[model samples]
Target: MGAPVEIRGLSYAYGSGDLARPVLREVGLAVGPGEIVLLTGPSGSGKTTLLTLIGALRAMQAGSCRVLGQELAGAKEAQRVLLRRRIGFIFQQHNLLGFLTARQNVAMALELDPGTDEAGRLARAGRMLEAVGLGDRTESKPAQLSGGQRQRVAVARALAGDPGLILADEPTAALDRQSGGEVVRLLRELAKQRGVPILLVTHDPRILDIADRIVAMEDGRILPTEKAEPAPAA
Candidate 1:
């Protein structure tokens, strides 16, 4: 079976003051395993909102969202927390703790999973950082790393748990053009190598070439992109 994502008539809105100000409406899409999907739109187009919903960071007010066979729409808070642990997330800000070293940040995710021994956890964290080109900087804190390096550390942190899916929100926004391209490439390569589906939310057009599919959102609605056959390896 493929690592399929099925979203059906998804809808969401912020604030209870007025229902007219919905952020997402009737959004629907699917991505198979190893697919790199780009979610692009203008500002306030609900790109981030959609990514959050898919990642189980926000409650689904309507419709259904299923990732790796887990339904999120009606899941309880505890269940949502459990679901999130299985998925990797990279935010635009590289939200790393300033006090923690790169290796520590990655290892933190492994700690969330039960029965992970200390040696195995650290080894996995080290491998993830190494994969993102941060092998020697494992001990470096976030403040010590450059913008690109920090973002790479964030990528390493996200991949530490061997998540089945990765949701990245403008992960390359903080880097220079060259560095941004490298980060995007790294994300695509990791998704392919791990057979994990990647949903990247961004307005930048530079990295669209790396995406196997592109879904455009505007005014809280998702427009379908051309469907391609699932990559054989994923």
Candidate 2:
């Protein structure tokens, strides 16, 4: 298979005319399967913008961006939906339904994949939660779980689909150092064992050691080194 994500001369701007503000400028990067690339940059450096573009959550504007070999620039909604099925995302917010148990929260991810039977989805969800050290809390509601545990549930949900690529934005920012460390370890193991590419946007230096490569960004452009420590993507 080709690289899970490839971008060349990609650029993006917000608004139009007088309000147009560039968020990404000629960003070029490629992520090979089984590798974890950490993207670190100050706020508004286009890190999240790039992730959103690659995730097909937003319409692509300039240059070329290919995920799993499908060109995404100006892709239609159906095409974007088709492409997104093969990708997983873990964002800062868990976004779990309060009424759902952890297991149910994770199993719901299978809704996107109609091929998976209910039994199979639960089985896979259980295994994934176990992988992230949340096996014992499978039936707990979001309110019953700790911040770290909830995030792990989010991780399990994102990975249960056997996605080919993972895009994590500040996956560890809300957790303590130890919890953050565990999350990164789980992510690293998943990327390596499944041969899935990961592009994580994080300012957490604690997990930087887990990355195979580090790409810095600044002012909507990738930089040689991070210019300043910026807050999590807004």
Candidate 3:
């Protein structure tokens, strides 16, 4: 099965009455399996908002959003929760539980599924952390890890569920250039290897070269997809 995401005429608004303001307008986009789509825009350009919508963190206020063929526009609360478990999400902030170890944080995702056994969940979490280069730090708390490592742990947690779609919001914003590049490369590799579609929201141009396609946004509207120039051969 392919990882297909479709958003049509999507719109989102904040506040109410006279204070209400729209954040997105008529936004439309589609991402296929194994596609690495980079969404770039300045702060308040609705990039994060768009990601939140795609991740089912917020309700669809207008238009339609379908992930893996399920419509999100009018989905009930329970349905949204179901969709969330199927979609992985990485935010700018690591969002790890402070008191929990990295391995525990990753295992939390699997706990939602009744079919997951305790041993299998831990094994899967450990393997995912190792894949993201955090194998040795599985027992460490978020406070003990570096910024890049924390982000990697977050990535590992996202992948623990074996989601078909991954949505990342400025995941590398807190890391150094080299670390950020490495993280992007890891995400691309995961997408390619697992046939998962990745929608990354970031303002950094440094990692743009690693994306399969770039979608620029302005004032909440998605610009056309542009082919990014290839990186220099190593």
Candidate 4:
């Protein structure tokens, strides 16, 4: 198979005609299996927009984007849904249902795959929570956990489904130095072990060391390579 994500000349905009605001311009990118790629840029640079398109969360507006071996342009909603199922997503907000326990939130993701029985789903959820250092908090509601712990639950939820690709947007934005480091460490370890490629968007310099490659963006276009240059703060 090819790279988990491959793009060529991708572009997207909001509005139309003279009122249109372009967010991405002729973007091209790829994320390899088991690779950790960081998308770094200032605010309004279209990093999140690119991530949404690759995750099938948004319809393709223009250009070619193939994610997890599926072409996104012109893909039907059903096809996009299936593609989304194969990808994991993490965001700035933990987005855990306040009433649900960590394991329950993770199991919710398993529901997308009908192949697993309810019991199996729960069991896998427990294991994944443990993997993310949340074994004791499996039954704890999101409200009961600390910010870092809740984010860890979010990570478990994203990985429990055994997705082929992981797209994270500012996952560490709300975290402290120690918490952010722990979160990215877990993600890197899991990605390497499972051979799942990760496309992470972050302006956090503390976690840049986790990336195999850092692609910087500015003004809706990818910046030319400059070795070890840091991304601007959001």
Candidate 5:
């Protein structure tokens, strides 16, 4: 199956009527399986807005945005929730539960799926943490682990489901150069390993080499490359 995500002429605004402020304008993009599409732009360039729309965290305002082949032009709340479960999201903040251990935080992802038991969840979470090189810190709480370790735990949690699509927002923004590169390498390896597509919104030039394609945005539209062709996939 193709990796989830297809957008065409997508536009969005924060408010309604005259008070509305446009966030995206005629944005079109596609992410194929096993591809890493890097989205780069200045702040307020609508990169995050587009990522949220693809993650179904925000409803589509206009145009075609089919995720996992399901049209999201006017999808219902229930539909959005279902679509979200099939995608992995890595945020710049890490967003780990402050009170939970690294293992518990990762296990929380398995809770979203109905059939996984407690034992299986823990086992899987442990393995994912291990994969992220945090096997020894699984029992540490967010406060106890270093920033890199915490972010690695977040990565572990995001991948627990092996979602067909991954949406990452400046995942390495807070880390040092080495830590950031390590995380980017891990993401690139995992995405290709399972043939999952990743849409990473980042300003870090250091990680650009990890992407198969790079698309830049300004204001609210995707900027065309020097070739005068759309940088985004159709």
Candidate 6:
């Protein structure tokens, strides 16, 4: 298969005419399978805008954005919706339901998969929670867990559907240093294990070690990327 994500001469703007404010300018990027790419820059550099375009959360405005081998430049809303289901998304907030247990929150994501029965969904959700080191806390509610644990549940929920690509936006911004470290490490491990390509936007320098490449953005354009040294053997 081709790279999960590819972009060329991509640009995006908001408003109309004189009110229009461009957020991405001639951006080009690609995320290969099994690769972990970190997008870093100052606020309003367009990191999140790029993620949204790649995730199909926003309609493409200019240039080509191919995701999972499908071009998005002129795709319909229905197509965008379909493309979205194939992508896993994580954000700064956990966005978990306070009423649901950890396992239930993850199982909810699987409900979108038409092939799985209720029992099968729960089983897979439990397994994913376990993979995130939350097996013992699967029965706990969001309020009953720490911020890190809630974020772990969110991660499990995102990965439960076996998505082709993962897009994360400032996933570590809300946690303590230790919690953020643990969360990003878990994400790195899971993405590597599943051979899933991840495009993560972050401002945290502490977790840069987890990336294979770091792409910087400035004033809506991408700067040259720097390859990160391979992680030391465990």
Of the candidates shown, which would achieve the greatest TM-score relative to the real structure? 6
Candidate 4: count the clashes.
0
Please give, for residues 32-73, the per-residue lDDT of candidate 2 as tens digits.
888788999788788999999999999998999999989998
TM-score, per-candidate, Cα-based: 0.92, 0.93, 0.93, 0.95, 0.93, 0.98
lDDT score of model 1?
0.86
- lDDT per model vs. reference: 0.86, 0.88, 0.88, 0.91, 0.89, 0.93
> Which residue pairs in candidate 6 collide?
none
Per lDDT, the best of the predicted structures is 6
For candidate 4, give the lDDT of residue 199.
94
Q: How would the candidate models be sorted by TM-score, starting from the highest?
A: 6, 4, 5, 2, 3, 1
Local accuracy of candidate 1 as per-residue lDDT tens digits, 1-234: 535689889888888775557989998888898889988888899988888888888878899889888888888888888889888999889888999898888898899778888778888899999999999999999999999999998899888888888999999887899889889888878888788889999878788788888888889988767554443331
List residue ranges in candidate 6 displaced over 4 A.
none
Clashing pairs in 1: none
Superposition error at 52 for model 2 (Å) = 0.3
In terms of TM-score, how similar is model 2 to the real structure? 0.93
After aligning candidate 6 to the native by TM-score, how far in Å is the CA of 210 from where it should be? 0.5
Instruction: State model 4's lDDT.
Output: 0.91
For candidate 6, lDDT tens digit of each residue in 116-202?
A: 999999999999999999999999999999999999999999999999999999999999999999998888888788999999999
Residue 165 in model 5: lDDT = 88
* Model 5 agreement with the true structure over 1-234: per-residue lDDT tens digits: 534788999999998999999989999898888888899999999999999999999888899998888889999999999989988999999999899999999999989778989999999999999998898988999999888888899899999997878999999999999899889888888877788889999999888878888899999999984222222321
Candidate 5: 10-residue stretch with minimal lDDT: 225-234
lDDT at 3, model 6: 89
lDDT of 4 at 149: 94
Q: Which of candidates 1 and 3 is the stronger one according to lDDT?
A: 3
lDDT of 3 by residue, 89-193 (tens): 988888999999999999998998899898888888999999998899989999999888888888999999989899998888888998888888888888888
Candidate with the larger lDDT of 1 and 5: 5
